[model samples]
Target: CEQVTIIIIIINPGFVLVHFDISPASTDDPDIKQMMAGSTLRKVKSHSWKKHRHFRLLEDGLTIWYKSRWAGRGHSTFSVSDLETVRDGHQSELLLSLSEEFPSDQCFTLVFHGRRGTLDLVADTPEEAKCWVDGLRKLIHKSQTMDCKERLDQWVRDWFTKADKNKDGQMTFKEAKTLLKMMNVEMNEENALHLFTVCNLSLCVLEQHTSASLMSPLLSRDEVWKVFQDFSADGERLLVDELENFLQIEQGEREGRAQELIELYEPSEAARQQMCMSLEGFQLYLCSPHGSIFNPDHEQLHQDMKLPLSHYFISSSHNTYLTGDQLRGQSSTEAYIQALKRGCRCVELDCWDGPDGEPIVYHGHTLTSKILFRDVISTLKEYAFKTSVFPVILSLENHCGLEQQTVMAQHLKKILGEILQTSLINGQVPEQLPSPQDLRGKMLLKGKKLGGLEQRSDETITDEVSDDEDGEMERESVEDLTKDTADSNKQSKLSRELSDLVLYCKSVPFHGFEPARASGKCYEMSSFSESKVKKLTKDGKGSEMVQYNVKQLTRVYPSGMRTDSSNYNPQEMWANGCQLVALNFQTAGLEMDLNDGLFRQNGGCGFVLKPEFMRKTDSEFSPERPESRPGYRPLRLSIQVLSGQQFPKVNQKEGSIVDPLVRVELYGVPKDQSRDETSYINNNGFNPAWNETLNFVVHVPDLALVRFVVEDYDKASRNDFIGQFTLPFTSLQPGYRHVHLLSKDGTPIPHASVFVNVSISELT
Candidate 1:
């Protein structure tokens, strides 16, 4: 068991390898001294009896090579074993191979951490992290002699060109470079060259394949998924509409339909594209949900339109014939003025006797503590507190009896003073009835006051005399509107009578609008000349409708619907307040024959105050006008009617077709009924045996939000919904704003009448 080893030692830094015989004498040889600093070493070409490497050392550097130099010295092979600094630098990886199979270390990946390096992956699944480093290392080695950018460009051109995807002139460098970068890296010529030379070359050598598939294409490793959360709806999946409503191209709307949307709100093109649609657009979007397939308007478009909660008026419950229940309670003075403050153009007040003989503005004949006549005056006085109010209330009113009538005048004199003489100048719901006796008493008084006793005799005599006088005037002129110059001698006498009656009647002093007081004296009666009487009688068909025996027609028809349009005398009918009348047209709407403005040019104010309504405003009731500096607009009292069909749900079953625009007015007589009932019949002919005083009616569309406004010449007096309602319209159908008709209480026992006639203007 003898072993002999040769060991050699050199005292120099230059590359060398020496050997000396090692037997029992050299058994203590150690490598520590050789590795120690300041150790001396000599260069030699080979070492005997070692591993496959022949170790070499020289001035350039140290290295190891394999050789059979012991038998044949000429056959020595060397491989750079290590290179350390400028001495090595990037040549580090090449020289630092750990084994003779270093070039085949494709399975081992190098990750550089500065001067030191770590072995990341070894022969397992692909180590993306390591590949980045390996690629970079190979890139650095390949470009060892060039500048950073120059080396990259050269490497890219060399590899990225031939690496063309279609073998076309165009190269897929971005894609290839992208993949090279995915391993914690990026693409450049250096990376590209590294990919082409190292990763690409190694795989080819190992797999022994040369085909187009050998190219490894990759994109940069990006942590986009970790950084960004994608909230967009997945394509072709069910996303809740509310959660993510993305509109489609058409969304069922015609191309131009969107233009309409632009007009209402600001809709931009981008918004339109994003399904940020308009209200109409929403309708189009939900058209399927609504199933209103036939709606040519908006309904056919947006399928999902949904309405808010429902609404109705408080007064919808009451259905009366005349809608008279609209006037139940007297408004507070504050309420009245408040109404005026809010732009009520006119107001109505019923005059009843106060404790004294003075007439007071009150609705009921008898007053209770809660309801007093003073309230009306009080409200008016307060109303005057405001200024420059427009369209002040010209009053429209009813008197219960001569007593109430006198009281009405007295109250007007008290509150309005001269305005009452000026404005008829002037002026929700509950249901109740007035006593029959009160009604009867009022009627007896009206009939007597409208008597024909004294005038009957005078009229008869004048009629006889005018026959002869006209014969003379026939040769002269039709000058004195009321005369007849028949015989030369009779003309003088007839002319005198005519002058004494008709001309004077226009100035009849203090016509009785108030309760007939006569200062408790019997009111005087005067006679009129028949020629004069007949001249102003209102039947003259030329320019004005002459008042005639329309009572017969009214009695028979009981409605304004006279089938014969030719016989309809509008001027006379309205002048005399005849209830029965006719219109040539049946249907009404925007197409209705309306002559507007105060006269008949625009849309006309339909009805005029009846003679009875103004009869009390004769010279006797005239008082001194208010002394305020400025004047008021001739008070505008525009009474409008909102039809039943317009009331929310009430017209549903009836299939109501109505204009959204409201039309202002008092209750209108429907176009059909007998003559007798015409005067008092409710528009629909409810309560045909009617007396407007006994039963008045008002029609409100809805109790909710119903606002009944009334003002005086100075614009005063406002009331409210009786108990509850938040709407502009409320219906207590068949009840009047009773103050406009009967006394404070509705009983017509002591009846009164207000005659109103309407004539639509037709330009000849």
Candidate 2:
């Protein structure tokens, strides 16, 4: 007799008294959730909760209260508790009715947790409601007690008996995915592999063990659960190792899959074009109409560090420098010459469309007819021809769409290509285009469909920006696809570029109010665009590209942090042509300290440093890399940092901590190192710990050296060392990527304070 059991999970709390603002997130049945939570639910934006009502957020489940008497005896506790009573018409009264159905001094609280902040309700009126809650809690706990293995075993035997109709042992990916969906985990290719590999890859290992293994082929149903029980530590679905195991194919198969996957990736050149045309990735917020084709006022900057621009500035809504004079003005040719004279490598040239549809130089969005492209080319040819390379980038302002902008970009690319080709024939941009794809290949379409955000968009309701912290998040997902194969060579190359740009790369500095994306409501829940629509849903977290046996970081990246649409990877974007991605430190509670890539043990700049690459076979990046895998090997780098940043934020939505003293964290730093040019300063030598206090001396160098640290890993001293870092030294090197940290170990405590003194010149 198949016992199809279902747990009776019903709401029994009678007198629900919520102190905070309560309302219906639902339109159809606005009163349902509040009614179910309690009989009397009070709500508003912020609640002035009263005495006698208490609230507490639990780690395991929800906590709520039911009020039997508004004037009952009880004192308020902390900031998260109830203090004043709130009445919001019928919702509160109706919600309080639930507590009316119960028997009166054994108080309990109900905490309703959503994706963001939680809601707390109190009921001190009746003791009956508390008793009911206690009973219901126990029931809920017992329902989840059945082990997955026991459950798996039952299903296996049943499936063997049923699918066997005659009982067959083998289950295909299709069958497995379906079975998993019924169990609540919707499986995709990577997810499926992750689950099977992470949970139980031994099934295919040389020592592959399963009940079927014991039987030497045809397996019985119950045996499946037995194997699950053996490997699962806490009986949780799958541990990280288990996930790794699921993808843990045999030596031969792993290599073959890597090769096949490599071919499926979008090319690097395609990615760069996608980024340029990727209207959303790099959005320009113009507070005022700019440039009418004015000559760029070229200024000189110190070129000791490899920052190519001797002196360049971008005019935006937000001023990059407090001192307006940090960046000077000059004509395009003069700016190009001055930059070249100062050993500069890159400069920004503003482009505008003229009335004739010809693109011309001037920092303006549009000119009388449209900027004429020929004028700018003539200017460059007459003056810049002699220089080996002009560290110049054409920044085109558009008042139109892809259909119109593409032509302008094409003209500019043509001009630059001709100019650079001449310089290279004489000596410029490294005779060979760094990555052929970046320079010669065509850009691919990042098939974007403009539509309303899907239902499960990341919620910003409770994730408000805080003044106390930078509010950034650490690493979201890590995909362990690095098993040795021939593609590793290519992947390594791309990863390095991506790593450098993300970690070491420096973005152009603007000397005006660059209207923040936040002000324009551009971002939805930290990532998705409110104006930009999601047409095709993908589930690889936030990733936009990926492929095997290729050396690009974008192809291997996991997914978006906030979206639920699966199967999207961004690794290929880096491998392709994209250069920059707009990221915010506030989202993760990290200040600008951990913003750069290479981490130091001097400041509380908790971030991922550059990752070391591995080649399963004998791997050394010599003159060139071998295209085929010499061996199939996997490598691991368990970095142990002595020190780094403190207060690298966590999701307050998760309610882990506002700014815990010693929280272990990790982040994803870029693989490239070309952008690392910064000064390093020595500060207090102490690291962060749970209780130990470390003193810091304040000092701001030109560039910064940053790092990330996780506490309580191994020894007693470990906690204090997590996220410790040093300030940048004045003697900075070119192409060095270090981050300037806040005043934790440095003198001034906050990052803004340190940054306020430095101009656009210091940061860029």
Candidate 3:
């Protein structure tokens, strides 16, 4: 058979189409090429906020177009790059409720975390859902590559906008060279001419052309179409076989999975039979929420969760009774609720005598208000195991008289019934503490023991004299605020009922590491004041401290200087293998951010497995003994602060902007390193491009948190925090990425982010 064929292409503001004919004479025709590069459409129903609508994926960098009834005019469009996540809707509790209400078989959701909130959709079957998820994962994984390709084009457009110095859409060769220099690119006559040619810019006539005659190097709409066509490949498209290869699927399951993905991503039967994926299809898949950091079926989720309790870094809270300062703050049960809800596995209670003879919890030697001890125990009973089933530690500082102490014990036994660890499990005295799995849904009490001395005449006389002078003060104050005096070494008596509950965590004085170990009381866990630990570490005894923490537990609390409940650098203590580095959970700052980042890993179960060297029974690794660990690699981290978006207002002035500077800190042991921009942008927080790079050499990456803090500069006082984001060094993905900033209360601030380029290498 003989035939003639012709091809045509159409371009408009809202859409682009390719039309071509094929015959025997031209079997390898333009239609095949068009099929490979052009956009493809599919009929699908989308629901955003309960409104079902029809949308299409356009070829312009994977934009989603809302079709309008009128031709050449569309409702609106959103780009795939704007999307943050796409995943199975069943994973969400809200959607799970919807599933119960509507009972759909196949459901998925797209999370455009920046502007567009979410797009929820339901398919006919689960098979379709799986295809959509897998295809979206593959496409989103390619977003980095796509960004790299488009970056240069974006730079060209931005340069044209900036270099049009007079805002007349034109620039001379000298002006172009100046822009190149600003971009840190070299330029010569040959390179300049080549750039002009590639960008479709014509050279100005030297004799007759004015500066206005020399036009911009920006591509016009038609020129943009031409560039797209030139870059588009003929017959270059993704096939099922290619996707299977990209997925690295095993041969046995390849055929079935590929068929499912093809159906999910390319819905049209014609496109499926053709065994090709159009550009538009690839973009749509990547833009969807198909990839996630957390997977329900991850192998780590099924592993044995049994280990010595001291072998994990438990998330703990300091001053859990107070919502504010230790001096004069309101003590409320809400503090306990908030701490428990945020995954705090341990809470502190400073028990003192109340007016009614009932024991109460409050900070001692301060005006802080008090709450009933029974109320705290009741709150713990209700919320201790709500967020997690892990064990909870009740760090009790008892300052009550024997009568009130007995009453406190009765309240705990009655309220915590069957859930309190009042005795050792299995009726055997463990040489070490039990595993978290062994104590799940149980609470353990920790407090000092009272002396059983028959005669207390000498000390009683001195105590009576002191009490007479201050009768308004409580009989005993929380010993945490009291320094260890000579009499502090004396063991005081404890009620048998309360003492039995202190089976594992016995609060004891930390005189020295050798004495603590030689005492042969492995069950005794000492709480060290932050200053004491710092002094010990500075005195070159950090190695001994790390070794002591292996078979026993050691807690480090904030120093007394932090009277306002602010936190210190937690990573400093964590690096020394301290088991319980308690922070003021109510305070929000860089210290808390670092603490949050370190605990964010290990599934946020409030238990992170200690590093092998730190957990070893007979190991020698320490902050001072770096030479003992041969495998410790020093990391060289280089971060480029590119720009920021959606910056919040710093002042109340109507049109006020922020004077923003980025502070990058490496929080770890040995020392914390910090470097901030010497100067800041005057009044532009949104899109303040510094293109500045900061570098750091880290000695302990495992215990380190890389903190990116954005602050509004203040010349007269400490800089005000705007927003910040934190993550462990190990979890960071190197290259250009966006860090979503979080507010003071740890809630994500939408549409707020810092664009950065990170490069990590081993420091020789």
How well does each candidate superpose onto the true structure, as a TM-score?
0.20, 0.22, 0.61
Q: What is the Å distance of residue 459 in model 3 from its true position? A: 20
Which candidate number has the best lDDT?
3
**Model 2, C-alpha of 657: deviation from truth (Å):** 16
Worst 10 residues of 3 by lDDT: 204-213
Candidate 2, backbone clash total = 190
1-764, model 2: which lDDT tens digit per residue? 12222111112222111111112222233222333344432322223443332233221122233343454754232211111122221222113333343211323333221111223334444443443344334423432342323233333333322222212334444454443433222235665544433323232322111222222211222222333344445543333344223223211113223222222221233533332111111111000001001001111222221211111111011011011111221123323332222222223333334455554443221111222445444444443423322223322222223333455445444655443321121323221122211222111111111221122223212222221111121112111132233322221001111111111011211111122221211111111211111211123211121111112111111132322212222212222211212221112223223322222211211111111222111223111111222332221211111122223332222212222232212222122111211121122111121222221211112122323232223333333222333222222221101222333322211111010001112211
Q: How accurate is candidate 2 locally (lDDT)?
A: 0.24
Off by over 4 Å in 3: 1-304, 449-492, 671-684, 688-692, 713-719
Cα lDDT of model 3 by residue, 183-202, tens digit? 32335666655554442322
Report lDDT per candidate: 0.23, 0.24, 0.61
- If ranked by TM-score, best first, what sequence of candidates would result? 3, 2, 1
Reference-based lDDT, residue 611, model 2: 14
Best by TM-score: 3
Q: Estimate, for each residue in 597-680, the C-alpha lDDT of model 1 and write its tens digit.
A: 111101111211222221221212101111111221111122212111101111222222111111122221121101111221
Off by over 4 Å in 2: 1-392, 398-595, 598-634, 637-660, 663-764
